[model samples]
Target: MNFRKVRHVVRREYLESVRKRSFLLGLVATPLMMGAMIFLPFVSEGLVSQEEMRVSILDRTGRYGAALIADASPDLILTLAPPGMAEEELDARVAAEVLTGWILIPEDFAETGECTYRSGSITNLAVLESLRTRLGLSLAGAKAQELGLPSEDVESLLRPAEMRTVRVGHAGAREGDFTQVYLRAVMLVMTMFFALIPTGQILMRSVIEEKSNRVIEVLLSSVTPLELMVGKIIGLGAVGLTLLGAWASVGVLLSLRLGTSLPISGGEIGMFVLYFLPGYFFFAALLGSIGSICSAERDAQPFLMPISLTLILPVMMGMAIAQAPDHWVARAFSFFPPLTPSLMLFRYAIKEPPAWEILATWTTLVLATIAMFGVSARVFRVGILMTGKRPTLPEIARWARER
Candidate 1:
C-alpha cells in the first residue's frame, strides 16, 4: 500500500465534503434546531395569553364564599352568584360565554364535603387546579376554626414539602436533576446517531457516483482499492469528528452563557470517542460495500433499510434503558456491536457501569468492527467494478469469499 497515495485520497475526500454548501448549512442549522427544541417550550409558556377568567360561586351555606374570593388570583374574576339564580339560567350564561365557569356548594352543612364545577371548556387545567386548591384551602380553614386551631397552621399544613436532589459521586455530592442529566445523555446519543447516518450515506453515495462516472477507475490506477477505501473512511470519519467538535464547542459556550451546565465529565467524552470511532467505521464500511455493489441510490435502499432500522432500535428503547441501566436486558445490549455505542452511552449517562463491564463491551465492539471491515473490503474489491442488476445475497457472499 502506498501511504502517499492514501494521504492524497484523504485530503481530496475531506476537502470535497467540507466545502459543500449543504455541509456548511447543516453545520449551523443543527445546533439552532437543538436549541429551539430545548428552549421553545419555556418561550411558548411565557407567550400564553394572560387574560383574566370570570367565575361565579354559589354558596348556599354562605360561610365560605368570601374566603374563596379573597384567596383567588388576580387572573380570576371571582363573584358571588345572584340570589335565587336557577341552575338552568347559570348554564345558559356559561354557554353564552358570559362566565368561564361556575362553582356550586351544596346547601347541606358540610356533611359530604363535595362541590360541583360547570364550564363550557374544562380543558383549562391551570384554572381548574387553582379553583380546586382555593376551595380546599377554604374548607380546611373553616374546619380549623371550628376546632379552635389557627388558620395559618392549617395553611402551613396544606403546603406541599419541597425536596432537593443531590447526586453523590466519587468526586463528591453535586446538585443534579433528572431532566438535565437525561437531556444531556440523550443529546450525546442523538449527536452520534445523526452524525453516523448522514456521513455513511455520503460515503455510499460518493462511491456510487465515482464508480458510475469512471472516477474510481482513474483513482484505482494511482492507489489500490484497499488504500482508496481506507482513505475515504478515515477522511469522512474526520469530517464527522469536525462536526462533533464544532457542536461541542457551541454547547460549551451556551452552557457558560446560560449558567446551565451539562453533567458530562471528561471521562464520558472519552468513552463517547471510543465508541463513536469504531461505530462510524463499522457503519461506513457496511455502507461503502453496499455502495460498491449498487449503481444507483434507489438500488441501495433495500440494503440500507435494515441497517437503518438496526441503528434506530436502541434509540426507540432509550427510555427503558435509562430507567433501568443495570437491567440484564440493557447489559446484554451493550455487548451487541450494532447497539453497543448508543445503548452503552445511554446507560453510562444514567449510571456508570463497573470498569470490567466497560472494558468487555469496548473489546467486543472493536473486534466485531474489525471483522465487519475485513468482510466489507473483500466485497468492495470485487463489486467496485461490477455493473448491472443488483446482486443477490449469495452472489455478494461469493464475492466476499473470493481469494
Candidate 2:
C-alpha cells in the first residue's frame, strides 16, 4: 500500500520498456505498417495494370454466341470455340495459360437460366456476373424479336432498380453501407489487438522472468504484491497507449493522403478510447495471473491458449457484424464481458446502439476489470514466490478466496 513504492515500480517498468530498441522500432515501424496496410490497396489500384481476360465460349444454342462476341468490352474478350472442340482440350488450354477461362451456354439456357463456367485459375465473380447479364440480355432480345418487340423495349423491361440504404436513429437518417461496417470492424479489431498484445506480453514476460530470477521475493520485502501488480499493469498500459497514438497518427496521415475518411466519427473514437482501457486491463491482468501461476512461458500455454482464443472470437465475428450489426448474436457479444469493447465498437460504427446498451456494456467491463485484477493480485501473491511447479486450478482458486 506504499504509494512511493508503487510509483517507483511504475517508473522502473515504464522506463525499461520504453528504453528497449524493440520499443523504439515499434513506435516508428508499427504505424507505417498499419497505414500502408489500410491505404496501399487503394493507392496501388491506379498503378497496377490488369491484363484483359479472354474467355472462350462453347455455344450449344448458337443463338447467343454472336451477341456475346459483339458486346465484349476492353477487359473481357469472348471468343467462339470451333464447333467440334472438346471441353477437355479447352480446360488444358486454360491450365497451360493459353486461355483465362471458358463458359458453356447450354441448349436450355433460356429455359433453365443455368450455364457452366470453368477456369484453372481463380475466377473473377465480377466478370462472371457481367457475362451472365450480357447473356440474359441477349436471350431476352432474341425472344422479343420473335414476338415483334423491339430490343430497346426488352432492355427497358430488364433494367435494374436502384436502392440506397439509410439508417434511421435518434440522430435521424444517415447514409449507410456495408463497406463502412467492414472497415469499422477491421479498424476496431486491429487497433484493439495492436494495443493490447504488447502490454499483455509485458505483464506475462515480466512476471515469468522475475519469478525465474527470484526477484519477486526481494521486491515483496518492500511493496505488497497488489501494489506491484497494479504498478506493472499501469506502466505497461501507458506504453500501449504510446504505440496506439503513434499508429493512429500515421494512419490519419495515410488516410488523408489517400483522400479517404476514417470509418468512425469523433464520438465513436471517444467510445473506443473508453472501452479499450478497461478491456486492456481485464486481459492484461488475466495474462499477468497466468504468468504468475506458471514456472515459464511454456507452462502458461495451456491456460493462455483459451484466453487468446476468447480474445480472437470477437474478431472472428467481424464479418457477421458487418452483415447484420444489430442481430441478436451481435448484441449478445456486445454485452459479453470479454468481447464487449471490440464488438460494441463495431456496432457503434454500423449504427449507434441504444444508450442503455452502451452504458450496460461499459458497466460490465468495469466490474470485470476490477474483479480480474483482484483475482490476479491474489494469485500473484502466492504464485510469485512458488517456483517448483505450476499451481493447479483449484489451488489458484483457493488463493483468490484466501483471506
Candidate 3:
C-alpha cells in the first residue's frame, strides 16, 4: 500500500464530505434542533398557560364538598350547590358552559362512598388523583371520629412514606434519584444509536456511487482496496464524532441549567467512545461490503433491512433492558457485537454489569470489527468492477476467501 496515496484519499474524502450541502445543514441544524428540544418546554410553559377549570360540587349527603374544595388546585374552581338545587339544573349549567365539570357525591355516601364525575373536558389524572386523596382523607377523618381516634393519628396514617435510592457501583454507593439514572441511560444510548445512522448511510452510499460510476476503478488504479476502505471509515467516523460532540455539549449545558446533571463520569464517556468507534467501524464495514456486492442502491434493500432491524432491536427492548439490566436476555444481547454498544451502554447506566462481561464484550467486538473489515476489503476488491449483476452470498464468501 502507498502511504502517500492513502493519505491523499483520506484528505479528499474528508474535505468532500464536510464541504457538501447536507453536511453543512446538519452541522448547523443539529445543535439548534437539540437546543430547541431541551429548552422548548421551559419557553412554552409561560406562553401557554392553562385556564382554570371551574367545577360545581353537588353534595347530596352534605358531607364531602368542603373536603374536595379544600384540596383543589388554584386551577380548579369548585362551586358548592345551593340547598334544594336540582342535579338537572347543574347539568344544564355544565351544558351551557357555566361550569367546566361537576362532581356528584351520592346520597349513600356512608355506605358506598361512590362518586361520579361529569365533565365534557377530558379527565386530567393529576386533578382526579388530588380529588380522590382529599375525599379519602375526609372519609378517614369521619371514621376516626367514630372510632374515637386522635387527629394526629389520622394525619400520620395519611402521610406517605419516603424511600431513598442508593446506586451501588464500582465507585461505591452513590445516592441518586431514578430520574438521573433514567435520563443518563436514555441520553447515552440514543446518542450512540442515532449518530451511527448517518455515518453508515454515507459509507454505504459512497461505496455504491463509486462502484456504479466506475470511480472506484480510477481510485483503485493508485490505492489498494484496504486503503480506500480505511480512508472512508476514518473520514466518516470523524464527521460522526463532530456532530455528536456538538450535541453532547448542548446536552450538558441543558442538563446543568435544568438541575439534573448527567450521572455519567469521564470513565463512562471513555467506555462510550471505546464501544462506539469499533461498533461504527464494524457496521459501516458490513454495509460497505453489501454496497460493493450490489449493482445499484435498490439492489441493497434485502441485505440492508435485516442489518437495520438487528441494530434497532436493542432500542425496541430498551425499557426491558432498563428494568432488568441483569436479566438473562439482556445479558445475552449485551454480548452481541452489533447490539453491544447501545445495549451494554444502557445496562451500564442502569446497572453496571460484571467486569468479566465488559471485558468479554469488548474483546469480541474488537475481534469482530477487525475480521469484518478484512472480509469487506476482500469482497470490495473483487466486486468493485463487477458491474452487470449482484453477486450471491456464496460468490461473496468465495471472493472474501480468495487471495
Candidate 1 at residue 181, lDDT? 66
Query: What local lDDT does model 3 show for residue 145?
Result: 67
Q: What is the C-alpha lDDT of each candidate?
A: 0.83, 0.81, 0.79
Q: Where is model 1 poorest over a 10-residue stretch in terms of lDDT?
A: 41-50
- TM-score-wise, the better of 2 and 3 is 2
Q: Which window of 10 residues has the lowest lDDT sum in candidate 2?
A: 42-51
Best by lDDT: 1
For model 1, what is the error of residue 280's alpha carbon versus the real structure, in angstroms, after optimal superposition?
1.3
lDDT of 2 by residue, 147-172 (tens): 88777887787687888988675645
Which regions in candidate 3 have their CA more than 4 angstroms from the true location? 31-51, 82-100, 111-113, 121-123, 172-176, 249-263, 301-309
User: 110-146 in candidate 1: lDDT tens per residue?
Assistant: 7778999998877777678878878877887888888
Best by the TM-score measure: 2
TM-score of 2: 0.88
C-alpha lDDT of candidate 2 relative to the true structure: 0.81
Ranking of models by lDDT: 1, 2, 3
Model 1 residue 27 distance off true place after TM-score fit, in angstroms: 0.5
- Colliding pairs, model 1: none
